[model samples]
Target: GAGVSQSPSNKVTEKGKDVELRCDPISGHTALYWYRQSLGQGLEFLIYFQGNSAPDKSGLPSDRFSAERTGGSVSTLTIQRTQQEDSAVYLCASSLGTSGGQETQYFGPGTRLLVL
Candidate 1:
């Protein structure tokens, strides 16, 4: 079985530019999550998708951030106008179930975004 994976291990962009980050969750996993880790800050939940349910976007920092999961497998996080403060490691995780019980989340290596 494959684990969660992310693309473009590193990205460098000018402020105000747009960037798209991709993630592929393990096959058959029904729950997926996106998180961000800024310098000197802990990991923050960004968004989540479970099965065919509407995504939870409450964790998104602002209107500039958005994401979508296609076919309940691959997901993409899009930043409309990148900012210096948006520089961070974007991580993706997947779990077998959505309940907050015994399911364990597997994380990807993360995509590092650097907005200049």
Candidate 2:
């Protein structure tokens, strides 16, 4: 795809289960980000990866959430021991590496996760 694409447009999982969501950024985009939007909430930043530099994980809501970008292209977000509060639409975004934290990002359609 020419834009960022996320796998498993929808997911339903039992509580305490683990789930993995995948994202593929546009070719050559060096910066990637993960965000989630819960009901009635705006996008919440989760993680960011830029090139081979250390990923910025400051936005993660809990220790159960983690993400990684490999080969500067694909990214995976894992949620362990999922809770009902973890249900949300996970969104991925990517941008050119030129502008540091100010670069414009293109977003994916998002993976809707439902924890029951």
Per-prediction TM-score to the true structure, in the order listed = 0.96, 0.96
Model 2 regions lying over 4 Å from their true place: none
How do the residues 12-106 of candidate 1 rate in per-residue lDDT, one tens digit apiece?
A: 99999999999999998989999999999999999999989999999999999999999989999999889999999999999986575588999
Error of 2 at 75 (Å): 0.3
On residues 1-116, what C-alpha lDDT tens digit does candidate 2 reach at each position?
A: 58899999999999999999999998989999999999999999999998999999999999999998778789999999999999999999999987986788999999999999
Quote the lDDT for 49 in model 1: 93
Model 1: residues with Cα > 4 Å off, grouped in runs:
none
What's the C-alpha lDDT at position 6 in model 1? 99
